[model samples]
Target: MAKKLGLKQKYQMMTRGLGWDTTYQSMDKVYPFDKFEGIKVHDWDAWEDPFRLTMDSYWKLQAEKERKLYAVIDSFAQNNGHLGISDPRYLNAVKLFIQGVSPLEYMAHRHFAHVARNIRGIGPAVAAQMQSLDELRHAQTQIHTISHYNKFFDGIHEWRHMHDRVWYLSVPKSFFDDAVTAGPFEFLTAISFSFEYLLTNLLFVPFMSGAAYNGDLATVTFGFSAQSDESRHMTLGLEVIKFLLEQDEANVPIIQRWLDKWFWRGYRLLTLVAMMMDYLLPKKIMSWQEAWEMYYEEAGGALFQDLARYGIKEPMSAAVARKEKNRLSSEAWAIFYQYTHAAAFHTWDIDEEHKAWLAEKYPETFDKLYRPRLDFWEKEAAAGRRFYNNALPQLCTVCQIPMGFTEPDDPTTICFRESEYKGEHYHFCSDGCKGIFDNEPEKYVQSWLPVHQIFQGNCGGASVEDVLKWYRMNLGADNLDFSGSPEDKFWSEWHRTASRAEAAE
Candidate 1:
């Protein structure tokens, strides 16, 4: 074998060295100027992607990864859902994970497809294409893997439509839509840099590791596959930021504002991920507090420190987010508990072990504030009936999560704030999401809250089963309504199989 080139070296050669032309070719002719903005680019060679794998090696690795991944997915499906340690109740976390993240992968595909087309430089453009394809693969593989769960549960169907139209779905949607609508440079800063490069480790790694812990092999595999691509995307983000900053001084403030807004926005969306990591996934990987401590508090803190030398200040709201991250896992878990009836997954009362974990992870404010609520819910659960509230809380017009989050420093009660524009009242979960809404209420107002959709008679039918059927959900016997329905047959059969396996063992 020849002496190996590192990823950085390959990236430098394929993307960075592409524009190293010595001959007198007019730079403007080579990189045509677009008059969308007044920014002038004197040299395009300054653009560089840090992770340097070219098309051939990129596709080869991705293909091999997918081959291995799909083999595991198929094997897991054939062997029944792989996590023996994970009870059905644990899938509530899975449902939320699929809901919050898988769809975003698809959105990444779409937006990256656009980015691949729009970027002016060939090297960056090609890299964008690789990322674009990677994202599309991620979306497909996620959906395929999760579709197995769809056969057994009711959570993931209609996610694309739900993403566009559902209320809670709006939290992520509004964040991405904002990035999509912004100018090209700002879009890069908003999505590629702040959201992907800086914060993605916080979002994906813990969950993947947790999936492994929880016996969710498929999810773990998919998470890893997507994350491998994320490193490249992060490189693109870093490159975009440096390239934009070096190109012109005026772009700094614009990039800075985009950084601030998207960082907070992306951070808020990761709240769902935090909850999933802490309370949703069985055999918890790492606490949100721990992940935040490592990823955001340590890695992000260092990155911001590094950027400080460039006059790129830390996001204005990062401190508040860091403070909230300490408490948001349990806080968000409460929201998930209150609302999971509407989700495809089921939520169980937080047990003693989980409570202990919470206490350890959140030393400052776990038992004193949140335990009482868990106790009450547990008591209600133990008393024969699991409390499944059907009432839909009014969703924020933008973020779409129910109005359950309280103001910072006061997590004891729900917080709801509204703004009036012309005639209509637009609701927001917090000042951050609210500020985003107020800045562009017209855009946020166009959101499709799924609860609102159900109320509006836009979904398929009057009954839950009809709605499920309408949404293309194919419920199996085990996942069928335990309340005496035909779908219960699957559960009966699964139980019978479990009985046989136990008896055999």
Candidate 2:
């Protein structure tokens, strides 16, 4: 905060200024060469987290920032600032944010905590510890940012319990769970390298921009502050990959496959964010197509080109990634529309403007594949019937996302991968989950699917009402309909006062 420090300057602070070489260095460095696989490290310093600040500097800045932000959230909620938003339509975007992202940050916190514990390198380990705290801060900041909306929204209260036992919640739970169980190198690849470095902007930036457009300063500030931290997290991910590659030749092939597998897996999982960007945000920041083309296709494409000099092939070949990106927005929208009643967010039919946006953004497939369904839904809405179908189909055991993804590049075909282990069947949402399960069926089967929990009577009861009550108490599912909540009451009264003030003026 003293002055604007660019990435290079920060790197110098952490890796150069604080880095010390001792003459009495132990025979084995804190991060030793991999003897079992015959991997050798030419130089550990080659592994560098680009956004480098020492632990003391990191904590001081981060703590001061969090204190300021949390105070804002407290003031906003207490003073009924949610009513000051430009329109109720803005809440729709915030609702989507709470549902899709808030819980994921918590999960990321858990995994980063684990990484801080288990990783061998003192430098990487300490960096991960800093990230572990950063993630928890992110989780808290997200909750606080959205809690103002929570006062007015229906589903914000029960998020924590839902994250563990809700069917949709499993998407994030499974993603992080997969990482937590992997070898140290792989955990780094999955979480730090692939998700943070490559695709996190796809998840966070649009929502922040939308919040800004919709006149939600708290959400925008919180998002930017957290993303400022993400710059560091991304550097850690890139550094982990570089360190692994340089550590051992034997590590290269293994790391390559992980890079391929995880990049696709994380990208596929981010379809929810893609859908949220396109449909849920009332004010469009950018279409999912545009974001993906720029962020994934161009930026990620360039990163792969640079990595190729080190014998690293682009993970998840460009042809397949491009194909997936083309279909991701509309396909994810269809799935979200189908299942949103069970979700914390609400879904509405695509209006003519939304359709026009889609047509412009996704020219090739929108008209042919998804438009008819949108038309049908619009008609259904016009018939005095709001759609609210809450029944869920079977869920994937591994990824925990719904079984809605269609086969790669084939939007018409449902993409569900199945594997049998020891005479039992395990389901996956995509090839990524399937491959992960196959690699370790023993691990995947132990996943705590929410639906399975209900069947096992671990939740409230077999009855739907009983289950809902249990979900409310455990998962923070408080007053879900805004019109009936205290936030709505405050909003109504504030508007009335505003009208009186205008007349008095």
Candidate 3:
């Protein structure tokens, strides 16, 4: 009997060999999106497949991961893993992941499938097809993994509804929405190259390692299951850039512009993650600045040096993000602290330990710039007058975050930038956001700013309670300070019961 074909042969047969030139329609008509972005692809044949992952092998590998993931999840749940976390506050980080990041996984699945169908190259099509599946699986596993917490937690119960309607969640929703709505190349450049490769570590750390450090076994396992595929996606991102850059010299500037825009957009989106790392995690990992230096500065610096051959420099935002790192987490936590009353997640008073952590992590800036406001909040909460910014905040027209971030150069004052576009004035949190708007004013102008929608009386009604109901958030359960929350009471009772049991023993 003849031997079965090897993996490489099967991969080629399944991917490259399956594609054919159209007979009835022109290639341009069939692959119209491939060229409209002004990207010249002289030979799609020159594109290299980053991985020789055939569908048969792909299914087997994913099945194994699913088995391992579910097994760990089962063990964790049956053993009551949620009770083992370092603190209930840690669950807020998990809450942020579900509402903000997990949905993006599903969005990524849709966009990867889009590029798979739309991009002309067979190699990328296969890569994107696999990545689409990876994303879908990631979304599924993340939901299943974190759903275990939903039973024990309040804010986690209504997530998908909250993601679409919540004020803070608009940051991630708008970020992904911008990518998916763009042309094929720009989508790939924004998501694949910029988000997945350039800055994924900054994302993975705060949630994944944070989970492990805090003893949420299900989420930790979920992170482990997704890690290998994330590595592959990272490889594909690099390949996407090389193929585009080396295909034509004209592609250089277009690609560079995308890198800069996405880098900034991604950095802004990560403000939430920065807060998670610094404030939400009960157990500390490296500070956001430490992670940024390792991930973005040193590691990304080496990547840009390699890509410099292809005429790509590190994104202009990298320098700005470098300067903002010290202040990023502190500022982000403050936003959550003030707005926690309106958010799906809970924010607690920053105790002295956490305050000290912030001081140690952000020695130069935290004490002078942020602590005064933080101390005020802590003191006010203790005095029975917890501050909630009752008024709706003005969101940046581009990034869609409340315009709270201060100047990177001058950390004390709010950084504001605006432009007159087609007669309407649009505000931005920073020059980075404003530059993105200036580049594509028409695209951003149509942004569905949630705060504006609420003012326009589109989000259920004008009352805070009415809007929260529309967001499907439980009245007192999901939105509030954590000090006297249901979760807080449950946690305290749990420990008290345990202590009684130990005494009886």
Candidate 4:
């Protein structure tokens, strides 16, 4: 070889020289979508990608990761790995992954594609392009890794339809829809900064750790593979935040506002995940409170300190979020326990051992605020009358969760906020949601509230069964109480046969 090119020079050669000016066509006409958002970008050349990833290296490394991931997935299937899980209940975590999270990967891919096309800078555009490819890979790998479970599990089939039509699934769907529909700068701040940099570890780490703890080889493999890509995404997120802040002093307030809005939005969405980690996993890895403290409170606190130099402060609801972490998972599990009949996933009464675990994890609030209610329900379930809230629940206008969250301060009383816009009443679960609604009334007013659609004769018919049918639910299998369900019966028989074989041996 005559000479070897350095990484920085290669990146510059690949990215910088790809743009040119035209005397006949103005740059504004060429890049019309970038300017209208009131964002002041003084110098596009200042945008930098920290990863220094070129397309050739990106493809080579990604292909190697895929080869190894597929090898593990193949091994898992050949080894009858489903039987090796800690418990059948652990599959519920994977079910939620397929139904709730996998589609979001696809949505991220779409929005990042938009950003890559519309954003003006060469460096940022290249980074967005890489992230777009990463997201698409994540979606495919997640589906492929979990498809093995679909062969033997309920609630996993028809997940694509459920993601769009279900009541609870609306939480995540609405979140991404709001972000993708926003302007480019807002989308970057909302997703790249607020979601990826600030909150992604909270979402990804627990689920992956739970999978590893529960002997889910395929999910663990896929999770690690996706996480490798997430490190790059996190770098992109931090770079974009700093770039936007460094671009103009005026960009600070706008970014802070987006941070506040998306942080709360992402936190509310993660409540479902918190419940999954604490209540759904058979072999608990860590309590949701511990994970929150480790991921968000500790790491996120330091991040805000670093950003403080740039005039960025913590989100407005940071205090409330910290306080609520103690009770968030318990309250969320209680809602799911009661309304699981309307859900595709399964839930059952918490046994005494599990209750003891909860008490230890949430000593301050479990018995005082949440346990009494769970105890009463446990008693009712013992008497052969499992509780299921059949009536529709009012969803918050912005977050779209049921109006079941307690007041931030009291934790005993339900936190319900209402606003009147153009003589129309809109409901919210908390002050944060209410503030978001008040700021963006017109956008939220057009929300496709699932419960409201049921009452409007728009979602199937007025009956719960009709709506379930429309949701593509597998009745007596996917929905209703998990006690004595087919899955429970299968687990019982599986263990009994194993015992017999061991005794015979």
**Best TM-score goes to which candidate?**
3
Distance (Å) between predicted and true CA of 370, model 4?
A: 1.8
Measured by TM-score, how close is model 1 to the native structure? 0.84
What value of lDDT does candidate 4 attain over all alpha carbons? 0.88
List where candidate 1 sits over 4 angstroms from the true fold: 1-40, 81-85, 157-161, 384-386, 449-505
| Model 4 lDDT per residue over 248-268, tens place | 999999888888899899999
- lDDT tens digits, residue span 1-505, model 3: 3479877778788889878888899978998787778988888899888688888899999999899889889998997788889999899998999999999999999989989998878888989999999999999999998888888898888888888889899999999999998899999889888999989998986688998899888888888999999999999999989998999999999999999899999999989988888888889888999999999899899999999998888887677788888888888887888888899899987778888988888889988887888889888888999999888888999899988888878888899899998899999998899999999999998989999999899999989999989999888889889989999999999888777977999
Clashes of each: 14, 6, 0, 0
- List the RMSD of every prediction in angstroms: 4.6, 4.8, 1.3, 1.6
Backbone clashes (count) for model 1: 14
> Estimated TM-score per prediction?
0.84, 0.84, 0.98, 0.97
Candidate 2 lDDT by residue in tens digits, 82-118: 7667666457667656765677777778777776655
User: Which has the higher TM-score value, candidate number 2 or candidate number 3?
Assistant: 3
C-alpha lDDT values of all predictions: 0.72, 0.72, 0.89, 0.88
| Residue pairs that clash (backbone atoms under 3 angstroms), model 2 | 154-480, 157-476, 158-475, 158-476, 158-477, 406-415
Best by lDDT: 3
In what order do the candidates fall by TM-score, top score first?
3, 4, 2, 1
* TM-score of candidate 3 on Cα atoms, chains taken together: 0.98
Between candidates 1 and 4, name the one with more favorable lDDT. 4
Models ranked on lDDT: 3, 4, 2, 1
lDDT of 4 at 208: 88
